[model samples]
Target: MPNTSRRTSKRDLTLVAVLVVAAIGLITYLVVSPPGGDDGAAQQPAGPSGPSASQSEGSAGADESPLSGLARRDEGDPTALGPVDAPVTMVMYSDYRCPFCAKFSRDIEPELIDRYVDSGQLRIEWRDFPIFGEQSEMAARAGRAAAEQGRFWEYNRAIYEDSPERGHPDLTREVLLDYAHEVGMPDMETFTADLDDPSLDEPVREDLRQGSSIGVSSTPTFVINGEPILGAQPLDTFVEVIEGAAGQQ
Candidate 1:
């Protein structure tokens, strides 16, 4: 293919670097073997279309359990950030105004976090990709603001949890301020000022461009240990990715 893309920004390069490192870590972990079956990690299905009836039935019992779709296993690996020691790392590039992003954050991420991250087995890195114009820009800025006050993840969580109606107010400064208050992030003035900085803005743009360059055309796109998984897929899908990567090691 011809190289038709324009100039790449430093932030975009940085986001690509993050994805590359994450991919290497995950693939490296895959050369090993897992100790036992994890109810949290979903196995790959039999056929192309989807899981066979029998497979679904087999997974039914595991699904009912609390840890049904959570990745199980922690070995205290270094170079981890979010949920330390996670055997599988899932990096997400998302837009706060995206409905799918909201869905993944409120629904899918919890089980993943509780089982993988909190247990020191998984690290979830979030890249805010702004694609919907001004509101998206607002949301991205707000995320950086939250980061400034050490409440990035919490503030990130709240936006998705309190998703707004389409065409309604979203990513507003006041709404973000409200979220900051709820999450205990003070120093709004400082954060707002910081948002104007190019260094702060580039990561989001880079994720947006880099994700597209890598065929991530939508929000909530994930890089699991270096593999790209699109949309707010089911937990079982994530489990399969993790286990597959782990088994390769």
Candidate 2:
């Protein structure tokens, strides 16, 4: 058999770059396009149905690219916080077993939440893009189950705190249940039931599909207002991108 894994890895890196270039094109188009459907707006191509024509039209040639498709805003997602119409939407793709992802959870994300999410300038939507095999998938399901009880973020913090900084921990059902308990999930019965529900698998899988569509091979890749910031990038990078995105609003 051929080395499909290696080939896919190579493809992911190239696709990630597309996000950066696409962002530049998107930003420029936003600057050039007239905002309130003025006469110039008539010239812009009608974008794909998923994202608004205003945002996706800039990504014209890359019609099928994930960046345009992935920014759904998902207004009523139970696991998401902040206003759906917040000026900037940050879509985060993370693997529960990835250390850098844990670092982002522990380190940068809290600051972002306080500085932006609290101010109603940013809305963050989480996507579980587990790439570390079964254990990672299990953890993602556990998170989704926790969201049923309004404890997704709590469960996330507790599990990442307990997890090692590097390496995929064995996230068996027992461990997942323990983390649920640790996060003060009110009813273990409901939590466990949700965890095991086969129906929950599809949402987690859909998250993975969306992440892959956008070329996310690594953990903690963030698309802030359609601009990609990969890995556990420095706080300043986030600040600059977010401020710039916010400025456009």
Q: Candidate 1, residues 1-249: lDDT per residue as tens digits?
A: 133232334534554565456455434433332322442222321223222455345435522321121221123312124543455667677888877678787888888877667776567766666766788887787787677667787888887888853222367767777787788777867766765666767656654544443444456677775466766789999878877765754
The Cα RMSD in angstroms, rounded to one decimal, for candidate 2 relative to the true structure is 8.0
Stretches > 4 Å off in candidate 1? 1-86, 164-169
**Per-model root-mean-square deviation over C-alphas:** 14.6, 8.0
Q: In model 2, how large is the Cα lDDT of residue 173? A: 89
Determine which window of 10 residues in candidate 2 has minimal summed lDDT: 40-49
Rate residue 109 of model 1 by lDDT: 88
Would you estimate the TM-scores of all the predictions?
A: 0.62, 0.75
* lDDT leader: 2
